[model samples]
Target: MSATARVLVDGLGVDTVCALDRGLSYGDGLFETIRFVAGLAPLWSRHMERLQHSCVRLQLPMPDAALLLHEARSVVGGMDQAVVRMTLTRGVGERGYALPTTAHPTRIVAAFAAPAMMGDAYIHGIRLRWCETRLAIQPSLAGMKHLNRLEQVLARAEWSDPSVADGLMRDTDGNVIAATMANLFAVVDGVLVTPSVERSGVAGVARAEVLASRAAVHVGDISREDLLRADEVFLSSSVRGILPVQAVDDTVYVPGPVTRALQRHWRGLGFPMEQA
Candidate 1:
């Protein structure tokens, strides 16, 4: 852990996790990366909703929300701006795939200094590339921020260019899924659209917020051609807010009005969206 980060394990300040933890051994866990402003998590309910849903799906016990929030606030302390990541795993388990008869879930809450605002990217738009790594279609595990992230790790490792902000990933069927770390939205035929997470991809908190907004947003399959020909494109995440897509490979885009509108909406939510 970085010296600037504060950690709490199972409600106690700690830096080490049991080596036999299922999260480390089998990747049996779920996590949420939340942005805190003024010592509060603005989207706390949404993050908890997702975490609860994932707990039910994974059969892992859900920690009490009040306790989780307490731990989150404890780690964040009085920081005006921070990033709090909550990791829940099916505690230490026997050396096998069999589920423990009675499980003791591990809760790790860590708070780090918020990353510097991507002012230039937010203002001029960000550059992206098509990643070779494709997401597998698995409805059973879809839409949850689970710990199995080998695909994203591999896709991210494919690039080292500091100029590239992120990479867009496609599913095995060649449908545009999302950026490695964010959900994608595009304006096609002047209609707002985001690819469905029912088959693959994460249902990010920011994406949910955008969908709940007044905009008529469509959730369906998006192809590379559709994205290329779209009127505008942007990416959304809880921590990063909204990022306009300036280009994908050689295809260039002039950040359009729709992207700006969403950015304003994000700003309205108390997250910062400033130009450098």
Candidate 2:
């Protein structure tokens, strides 16, 4: 826990939500999991863009960036490294499904210490499992980090083995989508290939950074066979950065040259991913 781990509603320092809040009644909200170092979010613009896109899709008013930044800075004040999560809800509403005539969006921002999983995972690699739960094809909800995440919740609950660092999930059509917690990427014949999030899955900020970097990137459908036969594989997230995948099921893959090059690239960008 961070000494500054606290939640604020709207712009006030508060800790509770109303019973009829739309976010509680229905999963009507968007959230951004941001990594802040020295009281600044390096990828703040990208996270804000994604949050604004989700608000537009949900017919909710977008928040002002200056206010959000101020609140986030307060929450992460004096922290060397922290994870600051901001959630915006549609506010309280009636019992019916109709949108309230007067919608007051609720904002909650909280901070926590960054989890300590980057040491060994970054140095060596992580083992993965194939999850049985599949994500439904909902184009309207695709690529948005909305509050409704039961699909990921169920997929993450499939395994209890501590050795399995993460699980890979597919869509209803059996196309590989992403890992339960991070975006999936594979290097096929020296080209960086990542599953398109058009039909499902969240578009991770770190994944977007890697795609926009000087790496050869391709976005399309990746089958199970394609993933297993790829030369290198890794996962991307805001908190964890890039994590190499050591094995999936019975197959084995050592952290290859491509993964190493990307790690170097990410470190050069000021996201020191290795143990100090």
Candidate 3:
């Protein structure tokens, strides 16, 4: 943790995690990164909904939402802007892959200073590259924000050029999945389309909000060609709100009307997307 960060383990202010925690040992956990603006988490409900769903899927006991939020708020301390990352692990257990007969889930909520606003990227759009590292197909873990993120870590390591905002990743089958950290969307022939996360990738809270909007968005498979030929492209994430894609590799894109409209919509929801 950095000097500007505060952490709470199980509702107590703490700076260290137990060495034997399952999350550290086996990556057996789920996490959420929430954006807090003016002491409130605008997408808090969506994040909690996803976390609850993942807990049920992984058979981990769901923590009380009110209690969790209380702890998260306490750590954030009413910052004007901040990022709250909450992790829930199966906790200490006996050696090996066996699940403990009695499980005590460890809840860690950490708050960090929000990243500086990406003004130019949000307005003029951003450049991206294609990552050689591909996501593995794991239907069981698909759409869950599990602790296992070696693939994304490797993909992000492929680039160090500050000009490149992020890298687009593919699944093992070579289908376009998502950016290293954000959900992807494209406007194909005036219709909005986003790749299906059923096979791989996270179903981001920002992406869900876009889908819930009045815009008719198609959720399905998307290929490299699909994006290259699309009229517009953008990436969505809870922290960054929405960012238009100016280019991917050599293929160029103009931030289209759809992208701008959504940016306004996102701002209206209390997540800032700087005006173009």
Candidate 4:
């Protein structure tokens, strides 16, 4: 997993970095996992928007966008196909939860090879297990992909079933939110419904696309029973695109009309299925 990376910090904007940044220390930062297409990010605007939203919510200063872009290009310049991870921190705040009044935020942009291809999800669906760890409902940081992801990490670690491609998680109130790492959607009576991310779950880019394309997308509190009784289920992420879930618990479902239509739309958008 060794790879080249670049760092910019503390207004000086030098590349060689120290390990003492607060982003690493207290997870007191925000980040975005961006997909660079043809040496460009098609969804760069969305990523930036989300990053800005996260920074405001976290009370962290927004770093210089032009510098961040320049650093990102440098990081991605040396890689063939890459997923760039940009991290912004509170910039070495004094040792406490108190915010530094005027410290510059530390920024790091690291690029690495895109995930190994897992083949066509449209033809062959993936399996998912229910995660035991329920999400804590935090409306304040609900939809942004913030740094505190220990809940997902723990949920993923609960099972070593490599057969299970991912795990679906619910919140403490039994509201089905999303998978351990991705957003979920279900087709109920020809309608595409995703859990309302107003309480939890990262509002994924692909999920936004589908909701926009298919105007009737319902975002509301969904229960596990609602998931089980649905006609079809699928997951979406920036990297994974559209992944149909064949089985959840003992009940199973094929990729139904709604999911298939969404996949078609997603392909037209840019990220085609591996088989397509």
**Alpha-carbon local distance difference test for all models:** 0.92, 0.88, 0.91, 0.79
Candidate 4 local lDDT, 207-228, one digit each (tens): 8777777767888989988887
Q: TM-score for every candidate vs. truth?
A: 0.97, 0.95, 0.97, 0.91
- The candidate, 2 or 3, that scores higher on lDDT is 3
> How does residue 243 of candidate 4 score in lDDT?
86
Candidate 4 residue 206 C-alpha distance from true site, Å: 2.1
> Model 4 off-target regions past 4 Å?
1-19, 78-80
**lDDT (Cα, tens digit) per residue for candidate 1, span 1-276:** 558789998887788899999999999999999999888888899999999999999999999999989988888888888899999999998999999999999999999988776688887899999999999999999999999999999999999998998999999999999999999999999899999999999999999999998458899999999998988999999998989999999999878888898889988889888522
Error of 1 at 41 (Å): 1.2
Query: Which one wins on lDDT?
Result: 1
The Cα error of candidate 1 at residue 175, in Å, is 0.6
The window of 10 residues in a row where model 1 has the poorest summed lDDT is 267-276
Q: Which stretches of candidate 3 lie over 4 Å from their true place?
A: 274-276
What's the CA RMSD of model 3 in angstroms? 1.5
Candidate 4 local accuracy as lDDT? 0.79
